[model samples]
Target: MEIKDWITLVVPIIATFLTALIGFGVTLNKIKREFKYTIKSYLYQDIKKLYRDLYVCLEKVILDPMLAFEDRYIDELLNFKPDIYLFSSKNLIYCYRDFGTYLFNINEAFKHYKIEIDYEDYDYDDNGNVVGVNFGEDEVQEYQFKVSTYKEENCPSSKELKEKVENILDNLKKELNMV
Candidate 1:
């Protein structure tokens, strides 16, 4: 074959391969972005649900006189409850934890309660027979809320807090026919 003909054939082949490669690269990048967004949104949803339930429970504590839960006790219990998780190619693990105000009086009035939920893990290095972990250590996020008492400074703003308290009282009064 003539050298010129060979060179022409090779150029088209190289061009075709490079084009294919470029297309593949773009596709891969798009896939990666979508994957990350999916994971972030999923994690957010799980955490949101967990927090919503937690808030419902916390509200009961703040408002209910015949309360199933106590703000102070919750504060004390905040040591560990509610957590999040993580999943990645390098790390196959899940984590979950959170903290918030537990007390609410009037002056710096509210004592915050921090809650953390840990996705238990196994401690292989530990000498003890303890195998798996149950929501081990909590990584605190927004811990200041639990430490502060002011409505605006903390959470469950003054209006929200007052509403909860009144709701609880109203329910109690109605139950007992107090008014």
Candidate 2:
């Protein structure tokens, strides 16, 4: 091809590459913002339910101490197995049959961001697929399970603490009634 023809063809190709790069940068920023907002909204809803349960638990404990797990806690917990997540991050939970019933807890798969994680940036798998999510702060959620298990020690005499946690958890369970 002549010099003018080569220049015409190559210049358009270069322009297209530059435009694509700009578009990708913009898309990245938008995704980050959207991910952050969605995480925050979900986290806020969870927190609200958690706090409400705490309030109820405090009321129950202050009013009555006879509300032990055996009375209604076990059955209630069995009915509503809750999946607890915290901050603006994606955390998974796993369970396996131990003896008879399944014991539930947080999934440590995302343990790299165990203490601290950023909700936006994450590492992708070799297949160019998103693999993990990270959050900024190393936030820890302390759930006060009302049931007095043989394992956990009581830091406070407040039976209400347990009830408070339970109430919040139950509410959360209902919220996630689907998945």
Candidate 3:
């Protein structure tokens, strides 16, 4: 065959190959973006729920220590930690670490102080009658002291945790181009 004939045959083959390659690349990139978006969306939702639940748990601890401590509050918090390590940024991981450390300190305080709750007591009416059973002074004072300590010493940590959660969410939004 002549050079021209050879050129024409090779040119179409090359063009078709190039076109297919480009299309595959584009499709691959689109898939990657979508996959990334889906994973990040789930991570964002989990983190948001964790943050809100942490706040609720903290509030519950303050308002009703007996009910709060009796439940699986800490276990619920633990459920989100592995996700932080797997999908979150380093900063977010560090923030979570700080929060965890704060929790550990609180737990240690409880253990060191030997804070125990006795689920027994009396209810005094306006007329000073024992209407029902409830927590006595020691238990009440212990909880009051815990509330005071949390308010004084732990509020800043809680605020820091809130800021960290907000920062992480902002970072995630930026990554997803939602910002």
- What is the TM-score of each predicted model, taking all chains together? 0.42, 0.36, 0.47
The model with the greatest TM-score is 3
- Pairs clashing in candidate 2? 57-164, 117-134, 117-135, 118-134, 118-135, 118-136, 119-134, 119-135, 146-162
Off by over 4 Å in 2: 66-70, 73-179
lDDT for position 32 in model 2: 100
Name the weakest run of 10 consecutive residues (lDDT summed) in model 1: 87-96
Clashes of each: 21, 9, 1
Q: How would you order the candidates by TM-score, starting with the best? A: 3, 1, 2
| lDDT (10s digit) by residue, model 3, range 1-179 | 99999999999999999999999999999999999999978987776666555455545444543322222655655676776587667876676576556555655554444333322345668998768866667767976776566445533344544564565556555544567
What C-alpha lDDT values do all the predictions have? 0.45, 0.44, 0.61
- Model number with the top lDDT: 3
> Model 2 over residues 21-120: C-alpha lDDT tens digits?
9999999999999999999789778766754553453355335433332324334333323423332112112110110031122112222233233333
Q: Model 1 lDDT vs. the true structure?
A: 0.45
Span of 10 residues, lowest total lDDT, candidate 3: 62-71
